[model samples]
Target: MYDYAVIGGGIVGLAAAIAVGKRYPTARIVVLEKEQTWASHQTGNNSGVIHSGIYYKPGSYKAQFCREGNRSMVEFCQQHNIAHEVCGKVIVATEQHELPILENLYQRGLANGLKVNQLSAQQVKEIEPHVQCLAGLRVPSTGIVDYKQVCQKYVEIFQAQAGELRLNTQVQKITSRSDYTVLETNNGTFETRFVINCAGLHSDRIARLTKANPEAKIVPFRGEYYELKPEKRYLVNSLIYPVPNPAFPFLGVHFTRMIDGTVHAGPNAVLSFKREGYHKTDFNLRDLTEVMTYSGFWKLAAKHASEGLQEMVRSYSKTAFVRSLQRLIPEVTEADVIPTHAGVRAQALRPDGQLVDDFLLVSSQNALHVCNAPSPAATSSLEIGKAIASKIPEQSLLASSDCCLVTTNS
Candidate 1:
């Protein structure tokens, strides 16, 4: 029997396992991943930007974790000889009405203790020659890296510390007993003294399997993207973002230069029919029924019906998507970009229709559930893992009487 069993082999789960192994060197730990490979979901399909904690509310968990995670992530990458860039990004205001919102963002960045400065239109042009903005906030700490590579390094170090990993092991049920928690999976049954649920897309489902009500439902929203043609990549310098609408959770369409020197733009958000749907044609009946019937989903839809319709339009029409991108860089045309892979965000929505804006963790006697983690999660994986590990009771690791049955694979 293992001392700790972490569900999900994504970056967060791997980081948590590493933290637990460090804290309790002698404890037996195992990471369970349903997929055949690690980080095949959200962790692998992100924009790969190392967030600078400029957008999160001050003194919030996201702000604190992201700020620290940025430093630690860079350190970890350097220590492991990983390829990463500490390039900065700009949040621009092209329209007159967006100027105030840009100033508000600058103030928020200052309150969060970020190294941010407001730039004039000429200064913005100096940084990004092809970009046009009335005003901009330059965040010097924002960077980019390949998170999948980082997750791989986390797994390497975790296994080197004697932690176990079981891929393609889908947990069918979770039963909490007096002394241990038993997990029935497709591969076999396993028992552990403690369980940490870091399942990203199906986090709510996993929580329910453990007999806990997370009080929020996972609503999958797909973000579609387009890559600039090789010759047109020069239009974007590093990263250029719009003044995000405070009322919305998404950071509208933005341009980002990847580590591989490719420029990606236009990720318009739309309601995804499948939890892991990467294409517009992909659909899951069960996933569709769950969201369509949920009262919270309807409430959220009614509130942002206009914005949602616009996102849908951008999703189907390349011309509309290009028009949205033209707000920051007026030179981008529909033919200059090509459709790329899309990513589905597992957003947690409350019964009252409020999105869980901060990191949400729910705990019981012997288990911890990561209910909502998205966006900067890839950037804040290590800090988030440390936070989750700190919450696990110390007594659970050293208790001898808690030993339970272990099922060996045949």
Candidate 2:
């Protein structure tokens, strides 16, 4: 029997396990992953950008965790001798009409407590010679690092502390008793005093299995990308982002220079027919049926139909995607980029059609579920884990409710 069992070996789960071990040094802990390796899904398939918390709302969980996580992540990397660079990013407005939007984003960055440098046309040109912009905001804390490496480092630390890891073990069901919880997995059965569900793609389903009333349902949005040709990579020096459309959940297409020195563009967001689908044709009837039947899905679709259509168009037409990129870098052409790997985002949507923008954590007496951990999650994984571990009542001497009451009074 283990004191704690964390589901999912992704960055979030590994971070959670690490935190538990640190907080309770002698506690027996196990991390369960259904895949053969850690970060086999979302964590492995991402444009590795260490976000600076410039885009999140001020005082929100996202802003708090990301800002702190940026610091902690860099420190961890430095301590581990990981290769990373604090190469700043720029959000540019290429057209005259986009200038005000760029200014607004600068204000938001300031509100989020980020160091924002508003740049003129000449300053933007100096940073990225090939790019054209009416205005821009320089976010110096943004950088890039391989998240897969970070996850591996977590595993090494966890194992060094004698924590256990179980891979290729799909969790089938979870049954809770008054004293402990029995988790049924394809590999075997395990009983633990506490369970933390960090299953990224299947988090909602796992919560439902444990009888937690999660506020939103996970809807997979596939972000498709293209890699710039080797010689044509000069379009971006670091990361060039677009002024986000407030109505849409996704940040528009832009340029990102990966840690490997290759540049990638696009990532048009479309309704993925299947949860794990990487291609436009890949579909699963079961997944499709679930999403189609859910009332919240329809509400979400109806609310963003126009933007969804445009995303679909860009997904199919390389030229259309190039046009979106051309807004930032005028020289990019369809031939400059080639199709690349795609990752599905596990977006949580409320019944009222509002996208859950921040981290969503649901807790019960015996279990804690992370239902929504979107962008910047990788950057904030360590901090997020520490935060979650702090919430585990058994680790604290004072009663959970009493502590909360005191917190409120204080």
Candidate 3:
């Protein structure tokens, strides 16, 4: 039996595996992925922003992990010679009404110990020539890098330590005994002393397989994006963000100049019929049925009906999307952008219609589950890995914690 078996091959899974391998050098560990390649889903499909800790609640996992991760991720990139840029980003407020929200965000950044500066309209123009905003916050610590490459490095590190990785191995069932856990898969069956479930989109299902009742269900919300055509790339010199609505988890449409100098726009959040639905037409009957029947989803839908309708409108109409973009940079037009890609976020929803705001971890005596990790997760991967490694029980020393984060000092 392997000492540890980590499910899912996303960036977080790979990072967690590497940390575990390092912590117990002699332990036999296996990283399993249903897909043939690593980071094929969320990690590869992101905009590559190295998020600052500014957006998260103070003392929460997202804040601490992101702040620490920003440093460690940059160090890793430098040491590994990964292509990256520490280009700063500006969170802009276009209308007078958003000024108060911007101030609150600035204060939140200060509370998180971030080096963020409030900027006047003219000062914002000095940084982003084409942008127009009533006020702005310049976050010099935010950066960008290709996370897929970082996942590659994690795979290498873990494998170098004699860790085994099995591709195309889909876990079909889990039988957790008092002594050990058995992961039955399409390829074969494997027994391990412990399991780490980092299966992003399917995490809830995976938890259920292990007979753990996760309070929240995973619901997929597709983030649709577009890239500015080559000639129009000048509109964005760095990252530009709109002040996010506090009631919602999604940051509004904004511009980001990637490390390679391509500018990506938008990512309006819309509900997807399928868990892995990257296109408008992609659908799965079961995925659709589960979400439609979920009381939490319907509650959330009813609460955000108006904003939800707008997101759906923007998802379909290029004109609606361009209007949102034009709010930040008035020069943007329908001709400037071309549809690029879409990523589905596996958000966890409570029956009360509240989204899990922080990193939610649930554990049994022999297994740990990372149920709801999205957005800044890529940025927080390394620190999160470190924390999980330090916590993975030696011979089930860990106890049962249900539907709550297994807190560790990061």
lDDT of 3 at 384: 86
* Best-to-worst TM-score order: 3, 1, 2
lDDT of 3 by residue, 1-410 (tens): 99999999998999999999888899999988999899988888888999999999998889999999999999999999999999999999998889999999999999999999999999999999999889999999999999999999999998899999999999999998887899999999999999999999999899889877668899999999999999999889999999998877799998988888899998999999999999999999999999999999989998888889999999999999999999999999999999998998889898888898888887765888888889799999999898788778667546544334653311
> The CA-based lDDT of model 1 is what?
0.89
lDDT of all predictions, in order shown? 0.89, 0.87, 0.91
> What is every candidate's alpha-carbon RMSD to the true fold?
5.0, 3.2, 2.4
Each candidate structure's count of clashing pairs? 0, 0, 0
Better of 2 and 3 by TM-score: 3
Q: Per-residue lDDT tens digits of candidate 2, residues 88-135? A: 999988777777778788888888888999998899899999988788
Candidate 1 Cα errors over 4 Å, as ranges: 397-410
lDDT of 1 by residue, 352-408 (tens): 889888877866547777888888998899998887777676665322111111111
Candidate 3 ranges beyond 4 A from true positions: 399-410
| Model 2 worst lDDT run, 10 consecutive residues | 401-410
TM-score to true structure, per model: 0.96, 0.96, 0.97
